[model samples]
Target chain A: MDETDRLIINSLQGNFPICDRPYLEVAQQLGISEDELLSRLQTMLDNRTLTRFGPMYDIQKLGGSFSLCAIRVPAERFEEVTEIVNAFPEVAHNYERDHEFNMWYVLATESPEQITHTNQAIEARTGLKVYNMPKIQEFFVGLHFQA
Target chain B: MDELDRKIITATQAGLPLVKKPYAALAEQLGIDSETVKQRLRNMLDKGQIRRIGAVPNHYKLGYMANAMSVWNVPDDKIKELGNQLGALPFVSHCYERPRFLPEWPYNLFAMLHGKSREEVADKVQQVVKLLGEYCVGYELLYSKQILKKTGLRLKAKD
Candidate 1:
């Protein structure tokens, strides 16, 4: 929540040019040295101030398909179910929500057919129905958090 | 388009450094020149491999108390028009349409609305309903109480 943290947050939300010395370019814009900027980022990551730093792809546009799926995993078997679902490389993220459909996750695959196959495999592995919710329309895309 | 580009994307997904010469530092890590790092980033932005390079915060921590995932059932034909209109709204955050999981659900288009409270989020939904008009057959709202994981994408490197 310091001035430096705010700057880092703001800079992350904005467009970063794909240049050779992109960090240096960002540093110049913020009037800082490239080495200093890099060190701060490393510190942030090491300290868990930032969870991750990477690209977010438009999987649909990339000819891959994805769905938001949920399952009513009983408390007794939650851990077992989590393991089964998380085993797939396609399961991008999984979460435990406070609802009957407590186990929720996202699966991105090369095709819609893959989505169905993956769901069936999950059901067979866990004996729970995987509610496959594929996006029907896009209402909003980007989420930029102002620090 | 090469191994270096993939590495750079993986390295700087969260946010760039906050120093005077962040690129120089990145170059040092990648064993490349600062100029090389800078140019690659510019290219990635142009190619849409990376969307933006900025801080993504935990909204719950920011006092935005309520966030709801609102799903709508719009006729297939009017989906694009309604999506564009809804996407323009300031309150809508993450929006997309998914295939209908029948028997239990029929909604399609989904938009996330965040506000200071549940009532505030409801007001935003009311605004969306007004804008969407009668074309919306049904809608459901799902509130998020916990966020398990929110992270950036990692590009697979070519061998």
Candidate 2:
């Protein structure tokens, strides 16, 4: 990534214009052409430097459910269990942490009740206890990382 | 949201197509006009249904390999104030108040910190600790061992 890439990545994390020609507007602000801005963003997305390029929807507001759940996996069966748990389509992201509750993941479902349904399925599949810890309150969600 | 809103969400959920006239492209695909597409997008943004329309960088790939979810056991009443302070930190990606599961789990405050290395993360934690001071009775850094799977939210029938 060059200086221009850094500028784009740092400046466009959260704010993209809501105008008719949003790209053109951003290009003007960044002192670049619309085509250049578009191509650069395309390359970043293609190369996976930027995971995605678009609007971020609040799934919860759309009548969806999200929760952070964890499981304590035996050392020997860690990888095997991860596969089993992640096989579920509702599992959004799964992570292995350095604690007794070693395996943690976020579950995103269509409805709130689906959380319990999926939780039961995952437990039955892995035979490990699933602890669901949903966020009681979200103080902040906006985060920007300057590249 | 109406049927139009739902269609728009499903259409652009994956991402806006990488094209010169992206909204137009969406309009053509959804059988709507470019103006309608843009207007609905604007409405969604205003309604907070859509947080932002932009790029999401890969922080792990961007050299911030060390990301820790710091859970702090702070006083319940003071949680709001301290959470806001922590949320204001640039490196803190997400800050939330979650329920504590007694004997097994006791932390209620969660803050996600990202850094280039464990040392860098630890240093940032020190700053958070100093701010929390005595209110933070206990805390733990759940350093991620691996990313088993990472994907965006999936709506039942659609992606």
Among these predicted structures, which one has the highest DockQ? Answer: 2
- Interface RMSD for every prediction, one decimal? 4.1, 1.4
What count of clashes does model 1 give? 53
For all predicted structures, in order, the TM-scores are 0.76, 0.94
Which residue runs of candidate 2 sit more than 4 Å off their true CA positions? Answer: B156-159
lDDT of 1: 0.72
Please identify model 1 stretches exceeding 4 Å from their true place: A1-12, A16-65, A72-80, A87-89, A97-102, A108-117, A136-139, A144-147, B147-152, B156-159
Model 1 chain B: lowest-lDDT 10 consecutive positions: B149-158
DockQ for candidate 1? 0.40
Per-residue accuracy of model 1 over A26-129 as CA lDDT, tens digit each: 77888878787677766666766655444454435434677899898898998788788888887887777656667778887767899899999999999888
Model 2 agreement with the true structure over A40-107: per-residue lDDT tens digits: 98888888999888989887887878999988899999989988998899999998899988998999
Best by TM-score: 2
How many angstroms is the interface RMSD of candidate 2?
A: 1.4
Kindly list the per-residue Cα lDDT of model 2 for residues B1-159, writing each as its tens digit. 878888988888888887778898999999989999999999889989998888899997789999999999999999999999999999998899988888788999999999999999999999999999989899999998788999867554443
